[model samples]
Target: MLLRLPTSVSEARECLAEGAVPIGGATLLWAEWQRDGFPALAMSLRGVPQANALGPGTLGAAVVLHRIDDRVPDVLRLAAAGVGTGAVRRTATVGGNLVGSTLRCLLPAALALEARAAVLGPDGVQETDLAEVTAKRPLLLDLRWRDPVASAYIKLPADPGGRPPVTVAVALHADTPGHRRLRVAVRDGYEVVEGAAPCDDNIENALRTLRGTALGDLPETAWDAVDAQVGAVLRAAGDG
Candidate 1:
């Protein structure tokens, strides 16, 4: 089948309606086509709407990963960088990362930041919590999130020679005088964790407790390492 390029979201959805599969970055789709054979009509998002509008952090689905790594907040940059090396990142896109196989980092990081996605489909645009997009993708159009006071992303290395499977991202909001709220997401399939402690200086305990529950299934030694690492991240967030 021929590769089709749509200059706008509406045109892309029309391609989908005509049985074309959308391909952002073409990284994931290309890998699949190489592993299996491509008998499907593919739609490339190269010219889609808002391709690189990072000024407001409005990441278009087609915006390449290298740009995301260089432009977004560190938390998300770390997540994007963790996906692949420099060249691969340049070929991957925001929408592709959101739906990448065995993705254990970016989704959680976006969740921690309270990001939202606008999906465009034959049914039109639907606004959704970015975290929810992981559950069900609808041809991601763009992603947006509020700037947090501070945010951090860390991936615990997988067991020797294995790919990292457990990653965590945390963001803090100091919207109130004495109460500081922390939002976090781990790649453990658990719901986004939210907790509040009294003031920015007091969030260490809250973070420790939340991580403890989420990492409870690990062996004691592993849990200890995770706890210590998370504690450091929380401290850095507070100080930032």
Candidate 2:
């Protein structure tokens, strides 16, 4: 197998003209490689400085999972901290985590961040919502989001060692009400409710629903914890 390690984005772009696969943490790709055998050509982003760029809005694809905890939004850090063990955090890349876990803790945070993603491939680059990138997809280059007043991520069942069954990400801009800006992923899928982060009204509304309601369906074991978590974040932001 031949691997091309490019130190710059332009160089990396220049390579894989014939469609060599790109590898960041190799967390997901490594599994496929083991199952289907190695590809003829692979591009490694480990040497690419541009692949680890981090700023208020831009983050490179090769940034490791652990590093993001301190660098990213508060909620994003919570999600990052929940992903596996220390060694996994050290080796896993943000780009990998973005596409690896189905019931990912990061998805809600990314949504709350309103993150946009750039895909780098033989087609040059294309930008889209971070939530649009599926686990089956590849070639992510970077993620960017505008700064908000407050953002947070939290999970249910209180397990930091494994993926949670439900996760919520909340974002409140200075101009926006903190109680209303929330997006939640029930499993691998989620929706941004039309209004509010969920409170009395939401719970009451759920009681009126016929079936399949989020509030109605919330597991008894996790509801109180979820409520408290959301409350704490809002209170920290002085919204409560």
Q: How far is candidate 2 from the true structure (C-alpha RMSD, Å)?
A: 4.5
Model 1 lDDT vs. the true structure?
0.68
lDDT of 1 at 23: 73
| All candidates: CA RMSD (Å) | 3.4, 4.5
Task: Write the residue-wise lDDT of candidate 1 on 1-240 in tens digits.
Answer: 788988877888788898888777776677678888885688877887564466455677787777765467667878887876888888888888786544634777787677888887678878888656777777888888877666777766666555455666767666767566666666643333333233356545765665555444544544454455446555676552
Q: Give the whole-model CA lDDT for all candidates, comma-separated.
A: 0.68, 0.64
Which candidate has the highest lDDT of all? 1
**lDDT per residue (tens digit) for residues 1-240 in model 2:** 688988876788887785677766787678789999999988877777657887677777788878884566787778888777889889888777776544445666776677888877666778876646863465778888876566666655545554445666666544345343443333322432211344323533432341234544655454454455556655776657
For residue 11, what is the lDDT in candidate 1?
Answer: 84
Give candidate 2's error at residue 181 in angstroms.
3.6
Off by over 4 Å in 1: 159-163, 188-201, 208-240
